[model samples]
Target: MNRNKLILLTAVLLLLAGGGWFLHDSGFFQAVRSLEALRAYIAGFAPYSHLLFFLVQFLSVVFAPIPSNIVAAAGGVLFGTLPGFLITFTAVASASLVTFSLARVLGREFAGRIVSKKLSEKYQGVLRTKAPVFLTLAFLFPFFPDDILCILAGLTSLSFRSFALIVLLARPWGLLFASALGGSTLGLSPWVMVPIALVGLALFLLGMKYGNQVEETVLRRLKERRSGDTE
Candidate 1:
């Protein structure tokens, strides 16, 4: 890397370290077990509570403790649907971008250290066909290991613009639903919520069943396109 890029990398690593320290020191992970306790703890921060909440959500995306949905839900309980979704969406998108950029700059070898050999191979195979689509699907569904996939995406040839667009658009839907369910004003009744929940569950199950088939189809199409180009 050039001098400027190296300096930027150093700065980001420092920020990640500092964020991790604050998360551990603040007992935010422990507080995640109870939304009421989490909200109350943030309330104690008074004026800085919103900013702190955003930071914790950002850190969770990188650190992988406490699901993003839970954080979005807490945001809803504290700030209502629109503001909560905005905060969670921005924080998550930012964190995902940072992780992806780091992986891109650091290279696949660095990402390999973060995930297991089998999973790393799996991600590499996925990237061989399409990064943006795979990333969008991973982020859209709750069942996927999105945090790890974010890191793996960095190793692909995806442009920052494409990755950023996918993260912004594809990621927010699930979190928005989660936040709405927790929002004081927007929280749906059990009768309404249960069906939405069921649909999400069904999608998750289908993803688990057919994800590999979809990947293989994409890969085969890519190969066909390459063959046609050579012809």
Candidate 2:
């Protein structure tokens, strides 16, 4: 049993290592060696490349710090509203799922190293909650680092079925928010970008803090109730 667990763990590590190497080999890493260069390169593609753009954005989300919002906006600018929206949404979902599962198979310790200390700790209470709705809230919040959170959430007690349902529920708003970023670039008011960005971020923080707190409180109360009944 121990040997099996070790083999599984090794396989997971090798998978992540493979992704890292693939990104490096594909020039995904080298392109972003300079953020300005990456921006210039992506911006230049705004006129004629949709599929390539989507691939870059997807890989960036999975492998680097090239933020999702930028990719979404670029999608809109490149593909023009509808197509960009659809393509960017699909890429984000795919990238998110890939990263989430990678993190899940990799385990909490590996996840913590890659993600933030604060983020991983907060996810623990949710893990203990063991409710589908709790996961939905976790995914719904934009501030939660959706991809990383999904990976961490997998480390929890939630089943694969629950995890997937929460992801589906969370998709529309996230997709819309990102698509808006990309699609918004086409319109007259790039300045309108400010409020949209703020609102999305605000909801993310609000939901993560409040939702997690409420979940923790409910768990505490339930434990008390159970203990009281025992006494």
* TM per candidate: 0.77, 0.62
Clash totals for all candidate models: 0, 1
- The CA lDDT at 105 in model 2 is 65
**Per-residue lDDT over 1-231 for candidate 2, one digit per residue giving the tens place of the 0 to 100 score:** 256656876776677677667656756555555434544556665565676667766665545465565566555655566776677667766766766665566666556656778866755654555446555654555434555666676676666666666666676565566666656666747578788767767876886668667656754665566567569
lDDT of 1 by residue, 39-121 (tens): 78777787987898798888877777568888888888888988888999889989889889888887754565566788787
Candidate 2 lDDT for residue 54? 72
All models: lDDT?
A: 0.78, 0.62
